[model samples]
Structures are given as structure tokens and as C-alpha cells.
Target chain A: MSSVDRSQRSNSTLKTLNRVFVYTILIVSSLMMLIPFAWSVITSLKSNENVFTHSAFWLQFPPDFSAYKEIWNRIPLLKYTANTLKVAVIVTFGQLFTSSLAGFAFAKMKFPGRDKLFVIYLATMMVPGVVLLIPNFVIMRTIGAIDTHWALILSAVGSVYGTFLMRQFFLSFPSELEDAAKLDGCNPFMFYWHVLLPNAKPILTTQGLMAFQFIWNDFQWPLIVLNSESKRTLQLGLSYLMSEYYTDWTLLMAASVLTLLPIIILFFIAQKNFIQSFKLSGLKG
Target chain B: MKKNRERSPRVSLLAKNKIREALWGYLFISPNFLIVLIFTILPVFFSSYMSMTDWNILSKPNFIGLENYQHILQDEVARETFFNTFYFSVLSVPVSLILSLLFAVFLNQKIKGIAFFRTAYYIPCISASVAVSLMFMWLLANNGLINQMLTSFGLGPVKWLTDPKIALNSVIGITIWKGLGVNIVIFLAALQDIPPELVEAASIDGANRVQQFFKVTLPLLSPVIFFVTITGVINSFQSFDLVYNMTKGGPGHATTLIGYYIWKQAFDYLHMGYGAALANLVFFAIFILTIIQWILRKRWVYSEE
Candidate 1:
């Protein structure tokens, strides 16, 4: 009894020490992650001369909104914002439809070359996306999609990662549901539409959030495919802005801040769903 | 007459079954296949053909078989760029993986307020790469945040983005900072999935916490670790957004990655065929790595069922 008590005492003490250490590390790392964002927020509001001369972490006076005004004056923020939203929404829809359909085929179908087809699908994922850039652009030009949103939308339509994620989610769902639907006079199409998709809401939401986040922030493809000033996505617009006024840090930070707000807001609204899906998906894998 | 009628109806029913099944399957899959055919497969084949041609955007592609590949094989700049990228991948992947795993292990404990910490780390992952890179450009530059801190401590202000020698290393540092959160979340999930009973059994067998971690936890966690490592390599090799925003292949091509090199050739220099050749190389390299990993996956991943 005494020996057991002694060990319990030591274990409790050890746990206490461990807790302290863990919290210390977590707090420091979290601060490190947050400081850049905080700095950006501060810099976006700083005066031009003070921003370059003063310490990055502190303010000289009450924060200014002049930089935001400058950013608005310099570019078509509304137009670029609209362009980003359009591309993201279209791509999200395309990915959802195509990826879910492909996932269904992999999870349920008993076609002649089913396994082989799935393997091919997985294999395409191994190919680095950069390799597809030039070729994709060439095809886009050939199809007369260059300088258009279709170029961006079409290229990402078949997302192997999305298919992979949806397939994993579908595989774990009990086959009995689909079997029941079959016996109840429902076809496979009806089973998927009415039965499966509603149940797959959690995974679908995750995939949608992912698709939105990726497309909204995407830089290179838009830079390459879209030549029109008005059609350029947010990131491309910012890069162009950077080049045009290389020394104007105030305006640059302001434009970046404006570009960041909508996504951040979107994230905040869906954050509960976002964090849950992450934990769930991580556990599933 | 009754038997004949019944038999004929049954045969027709079987035929109907075949038609309906085929139609439904086609209907379900047509949208996916159409887009893939138009976007993915066509471009893949188009790039293959482009690799054998001498096309710039202006002129029509002339069929000069393997000329671009031949040039790529012989080009010193392309060779250096690939090597530089490979080196960065090698350096960054392990560092990010290790750090994230460590962070995850620490976070996996039954503790209060863990979610807040996890979200804080993941915030960087969601931040725009262009913005993050731009932020770092100001943070890491001489007379920037980091340098100013160092100078206050009576150390020299390092040339972070300007000096070719240290520029790539700075990019690596930025990548690890950005990637740490995703890695931790992944590993933490893997850790949580390990049954507590196994750890209890190890403890009953007179194993300490360290011993339990090594014997019971590490082996079980190998699969997740392997997955994270491979994905990390792939991401590092294909890094472009950060490089493009921060360095733009500057300081005499110090931080030029394979993806940036391909971009420069295809878009900027108008060597579409040559860029295709380089892209082909990157594809093959990743393909080979994936194959090697598949061979090793059976040794690590332990399925419950």
C-alpha cells in the first residue's frame, strides 16, 4: 500500500512538471505564429516614414486608415475580389461534383477495370503539379481559354486529392445503407443523391473549405493564364501592385490586408466546422 | 403457352437490368470523365508532345524529336537549379517533420486550452503565401525585425534575402514555420488513435514513459510519420509561391527551385518545349519516390482489420 502511494505521488509530481513544460512551449510557439499577422495588421496602419524607421512591433500614435484608402485608390479591389470569388465558387462546384462522382465509382462500383482505374487515379496524384503548368497553359491557349476564368476553373476541376479524401470518407460508411436503398427500389443514382450525399456533409464541407482556401490564395496559375488586368485574381493583382510601386510598403501592406479580410472572415464563420473536420479527418486517416 | 410467355418476359427483364445498370454508371461518371479528358489527360499528352518539339509561344511548334530533352540534359543552369531544389527539399523536409512531430507529441496530452494553441499554429498555414512571404521579406531582411533583434543582442544583422549564401536557408526557415502546424495536427491525430490500453500494458510491464513511447508508440506511429515525410518532400520540391514572392529567383539564382525554373522558361523566356522537358523530369523524380515509398508502405502501415 505504501509503495503504491509513493509511486502515485511521484507520478502526480511528474505530471505537474510536464504540464508546465508543455504550456510554456505551446504559448511561445503560438505567439511566434501570431506575431507576423499582428505585425502586418500594425504595419498596414502605420505612417509611411515611421513604418520604415520605427520598430515593427510598436506604434507611434493612433493607427491610421490612410493606407487602406491608398490601396483602394490604387487598384480595383472590388473587381479583383469579384474575380477571386467567381473562380473559387466555380472551382469548388466542379471539384465537388467530379471528385464525389469519382469517389463513388471507386467506393461502390464493380466495373470491369475498377481497380485498375482507381490505381491510375491515385498515380496521377504523384505527378508534381508544376509539371502540368506549361502543358495546361498550352492546352488552354489551344482551346482559347487563356486570359479567361475558364482556364483557372478547368485546370483544377479534376482534383485527385479531393477524390482521395472523399473516397476515404465514403469507404467507412456502412454498406448496409446503400443495400437498404437498393432493396427499397432506389437506383444507385438515387442512393447517392438522396442517401449518401446528405450523410457525407461533414467531409463535403471540409473539401469545400479546402477548395475555397486554395483557389482564393492561388498565385502562379492565375499569373500565367490571365493576361487581362481586370481579370487577374487577388494575388496576381497584389504582385503586380508590388512591382509597379516597389518602394511603397504602406500601400503594399494595405492591399495585402484588404486581400486577407474576406478569407479570414469566411474562415471565422466556418472555423468550428473547419477545426472539427480536421480533427475528424486526422483521426480517420 | 403460359410457360413460353413467362420465359420470354424473364429474358426481357434481364436485358433491361443490363441497360439500366450501364446507363446509370455512365451517367454518374460522365461529368468527371469529360472534365478530366478535356483538362488533365489532354494536357499531360500535350506536354509530352511539347517536350519533343521546339515551340515558343510565337512560332508554331516544329517537331524536333527530343531536342528539348537533349538540351535540358546538357544545360548547366537547369542542372544547377534542379540540384539546388533537391538540396532544399532534403534540408527542409526532415526539419519540418521532426519539429511538427515534437510539437504534436507535446500537444497530444490531455490538457486544457489545447484547441487554441492548435488554431494559432494553423493560422499561418491558412495565411496567403504571397502575404506570408511578403511579411517575411520585411521580417528577415537586413534592418528587419529579426536582424534588429539580433543587433540589439550585440550580434550582426544578417543579410537574409540579399546574400546568396543565406537566402535559401532563410526560405527553408520560412517553410518550416509555415508547415509546422499541419504536421503537428496530423501527428497528433495519429497519436490520439493509439489505444490507451496498449500504453497501460506497457506501463504494467515495468516500462517508464520514455520506454513506452519508444516501444509502444513509435512503431505504431511509423505509418503516419512516413505519410507526413513523403508529402513534405513533395511540397518542398514543388515550392514556388513562397520563392516567387520572396526571392523571384534572385541574388544570382541562389533560391531558384525547379518549379520556378520551369515557370521562368515557359512563361518568361518563352521556351515552352524546354520547360516541358524540365517538368517531365520533376514528374519522373516524384513518381520514382512514390514507387519506392509504396514498396516500403507494407512494412510500416498496420491495419486493424
Candidate 2:
């Protein structure tokens, strides 16, 4: 009895120690990830003189917004922001519409060569986007879309990942809903409009948020496609800021903070649904 | 008028015989099929032809019969880029897989403040690569915050971006940090899928926590582990944004991956044919690795009964 009692005590003590150790590591890693953003925000709000001299975490006197003013005035930030919004919004909506419709067809409709066609679509995804670049660019150029937003938006309009994700969601949907819609003298379009699409709102919303994130964050495609200063995306603008190699860390940091805000807000607004859809897609993979 | 009405009679007759299903199907699928063929399939063949010719952005491509492939084989820069990219993946993938699994196990505990920790760890993943790259640039510089911290601790300042020996490794570190969250979440999901009953059985047989983790949990999680490792390796091989944003394959091209090389060749130098050949080589490498994994899975992975 004493031995068992001693063992229990030791186990509980070890468990407590383990908990503390795990918490410490988690806290440290979390802080490590968060610190960069925090530093960016803090530095952005600091004067250029105070940025390097001040302790990494502390502020001296009042916070400054002069860096923000500089970044705004020096770059056509508002114009670039608007352009990015235009491209991201169009691409997101276009992908959601095209992918979901095709996904619904693949998941539910029984057409001739349905499986074979879907297989072909899946095979296209296996090839890297890099391999398709020269050819894609050549096609875009031949069609006279170089240095245009269409060059950026057209290729991404039909995403294999989006279709695959929406297909999984649609597969789990009950067929009874479509049947009921049909019984009410609804046409196929009406059935989709009245029944299927309404049910897919959450996933569609999640897809929209993801698409927004992906398009907004994308750098390479935008850099490759857009060259004109007026046509540049936010990413290209940010890269330009960095390339100038200013000692003005605060201004650079301010730009980064401003760039991150929309995506962070989107993530917070759709956190639960984002996590749910991520799990759903992860399951299929 | 008769022919048109006959076609229309199909609508009346077809509605009774599941024509509604077929109409919706055709409507939904046609747009996607048209776009996919135009963009994906058509371009693949076009690039295959372009790759055989020396086509700059200004002029038409004239076929030269595998000259690009031969050049790529002998081109010192292409060879170096391939080696550098393979080395990056070989280092990054295994380390990331192990670290993420460990983090997932730690997060899976019914500990307090788990949600907060999860969100914090995931913040980097949510942040744009451009933003993260900017932050890392500031952090890893010789006189940057990282060095300042090190100096205060009586350590020598290290040249992060400037030194060729450590520059590539630094990029690998940043890549791992950026990729850590998604991998952890995937592993966490996989870990949770293992039945508690199996762990309990191992414990009842006088196994300790570590023993049960190894004996039961590890075996069960092997499939997810394999899947994650395969995807991680493939993704790492294709890593471009961070290198492009952070290093620009710079400090003497120490961190140049194959993707960056191809981008530079095709876009910067306008060597589209050579770039296409290099891309093909990358595709081949990834394809061969995937096939090897599929074959080896028969030996290593144990599926659930």
C-alpha cells in the first residue's frame, strides 16, 4: 500500500512538471511567432531614431505615426490597395463560382464521361504551376494580356484545389434535397439555386476567405505579371519598399502591418468556419 | 420550325426523365471544362514545343531539337540550382516533420490556454509571406534585433544574410517557422484520429506513457506521417516566395532553389526554353520521389483494419 501511494505521488508530481514544461515551450514558441508582428507594429509606431536605440519591447515617450505618413505619401499605397482589392475580389468570386459549379457537377451529376473528365482535371493539377508558366504567359501574351490584371486573374480562375475541396463538401450532402426541389416542379438551375447553393454557404464563405488570403498574399505571380508602377499589387509595392534599402525601418514595418490587417481581420471573422473547412479538406487529402 | 419544336419537345419529355439532372450537369461543368482545357492542357503542349526552341519574349520560337535539354545538363548554374534546391528540401522536410509532430503532441494535451497557444503559433502562417519576409529581414540582420539580443548575452554577432555558409540554412529556418503551424494542425488532427482504446490497452499491459506512445500511437499515426512527409518534401522542393522575397537568391545565390532559378531564367533573362527544361527536370524529380513513396508504403505503413 505504501509503495502504491508513493508511486501515485511521484506520478502526479511528474505530471505537474510535464505540464509546466509543455506550457513553457508552447509559450516561448508562440511568443517567437508573435514577436515579429509585434515588433513590426511597435517599430512602425516608433520614431526612426528610437527604433534601433529602444529596447525591442519598450516604447519611449509618445508613439509616432510619422512613418505611416511617409509610407503613404511616398508610395501610391491607396491606389495599389485598390488595385489589389480589384484583382483579389474578382479572382475569389470567379474561383468560387466556377469551382463550386464544377464541383457540384462532379459530385452529384451523372453525365457521360463524368469520372473520366474529372480524372483529367485532377491530372492537370499534378503538374506544377512552374512548368505551365512559359506556356501560360505565351498564351496570355498572344491574346494581348501582358502587363494587365487579366494576366494575373485569368489563370487562377479555375483552381484545382478549390474544386477538390468543394467536391468533398458536396459529396457528403444528401440527395434528398435535390429530389424535393424537383418534386416542386423546380428546374435544375432552380434546384441548385433554391436548395444546393443555400446549403453550401458556409463552405463557400470559407473558400472565399481562403481565396482572398491566397490572392492577397501572393507575390511571385504578381511580380512576374505586373511591371507598371500603376498596375503593381501590394506585394510588389512592399518589395519595392524593401529593395530601396532604407534605414527607415519604421516605414517599412508600417507598410507590412497595414498589409497584414485585412487578412487578419478575415481570419478572425471566419475563424470557426475556416478551421472546419480546413479539417474537411485535410481529411480528403 | 418543326425541327426546333422537336428539340423543344425534348425539354418537355426530358423533364419527366431526369433531364433536369442532365441540364444542370452540363451547365455547371461546361465552363470549367472549357477553361481547364484552354489553360492547363493546351499550355502544356505549347510549352513542350516552346522548350525545344529559343524563344525570347520578343520573337517567335523556332524548334532546335533538344538543344535546351542538352544545355541544361551542362549548364553550371542549372546544376548548382538543382543541387541547392535538393539540399534545402532534404534538410527542411525531415526537420519540419519531426518538429511539427512534436509540437502537435504537446498541443494535444488537455492543458490550459491551449486555444491561445494554437492561435499564436498559427499567426505566422496566416501572415503574408511578404510581411513575414520583411520581419525576418529586420530580425536576422547583423545588427538587427536577433544580433542585439545575442550581444547582450555576451555572444558574437553572426552574419545571417551576408554569410554564404549560413545564408541557406537561415532560409531553411525561416521556411520551417513559416510552415510549422499548418503541419502541426495536420498532425494534431492525425493524432486525435488514433483510438484511445489502443493507448489504454497498452497502458493496462504495464506500459508507461512513453511506451504506449511508441508502441500503439506511433504505428497508428504512420500513415498520416507518411502523407505529411511526402507533401512537405514536395512543397519544400517548390519553395519560392520566401527565397524570392527574403534573399532574391542572393548573397551570391546561396539560397537559390530550382523554382527561383526557373523564375529568373524565364522571366528575368527571358530564357523561356532553358527555363522550361529546368522546370521539366524539377517535375521529373518530384514525380520520381512520389512514385518511390507509393512503392515503399507497402512495406512501411500500416492501415487501420
Model number with the top TM-score: 2
Q: Once model 2 is optimally superposed onto the true structure by TM-score, how far is the C-alpha of residue B205 displaced, in angstroms?
A: 1.3
Candidate 1: misplaced stretches above 4 Å?
A1-14, A109-112, A171-191, A272-285, B1-5
Candidate 1 pairs with clashing backbones = none
Per-residue lDDT value at A221 in model 1: 90
Instruction: Give lDDT for model 2.
Output: 0.82
Can you tell me which runs of candidate 2 are displaced by over 4 Å? Answer: A52-58, A280-285, B1-20, B292-305
Compared with the true structure, all predictions reach lDDT values of 0.81, 0.82
Write candidate 2's Cα lDDT for B45-134 as tens digits: 777787799988778778898999999888887778878888898898899888888889998878888888878867777788888889
Lowest-lDDT window of 10 residues in candidate 2 chain B?
Answer: B296-305
